[model samples]
Target: MNNMKNMKVPSGGAASTLAKLGIIGGIGLYAAANSLYNVEGGHRAIVFNRLVGVKDKVYPEGTHFVIPWFERPVIYDVRARPHLVESTSGSRDLQMVKNWTSSPYSSFAWPATYSLSDPWREL
Candidate 1:
């Protein structure tokens, strides 16, 4: 009968609804994953926004959260590490002066000392 045919449900409609739900769920999961992150020990992180510049607050070692696609974290190691300071220059005497110094976190350089002197003295 025409009435019975009209009452029948379209099979494709149910499949389409389920497919849409699945896609939405997948997107939600992806966003949630991106919103969370962890900072390891001896490290710090800075929160940043797409529209704003670096935030003033620094996050220590721990778990943190942010809005996906709108914000991000930049991690930095606060631990003391080795660094080399070096330079080369040609003097008025037609002599080449080269010097280099290495230290852990460059202990000598901390509170950085600067002076104008003969570069050859450090060589």
Candidate 2:
């Protein structure tokens, strides 16, 4: 804990795991490709920092959405990232093309759910 002797935690409950972390760039969520929070029980301090920026990130896996034992649980963005590819070309299935799910034109509908096309728009 000595290393974190000068670290700071959220004051006045401004930081809630249950609450939205922040709105960045636009209305986008505060998503560092990773986050890290160091805790010190003796000093009653929690030092939360983004691992993505750390020089040698201990949390290689990026664990920011953490639920403290006493406080609210940090919320993970289960809302998958979206991509919207616009093309006048023919649909993918017609050409047997496979795009990364992150592709924009990937539609999330009921069709891909109940069948092989669930959540996907195959031409």
Residue lDDT tens for model 1, 10-117: 577888999999999999999988999999987777777777655667777899998898888877666666678788888999999998867776664342212211
Stretches of candidate 1 exceeding 4 Å from the true structure:
1-12, 82-123
Residue-by-residue lDDT tens digits, candidate 2, 1-123: 886997877665755533544434323322332233543221112223243221211221233344232222122122234665444444756664444444533454211212322212232
Reference-based lDDT, residue 73, model 1: 83
Which ten residues in a row are the worst by lDDT in model 1?
111-120
In order of appearance, the predictions have TM-scores of 0.58, 0.17
Q: Which whole-number lDDT from 0 to 100 does residue 31 have in model 2?
A: 32
Taking every candidate in turn, the Cα RMSD to the unseen true structure, in Å, is: 11.4, 21.4
Q: How accurate is candidate 2 locally (lDDT)?
A: 0.33
Clashing pairs in 2: 83-104, 84-104, 85-104, 111-118, 112-117, 112-118, 112-119, 113-118
TM-score, candidate number 2: 0.17
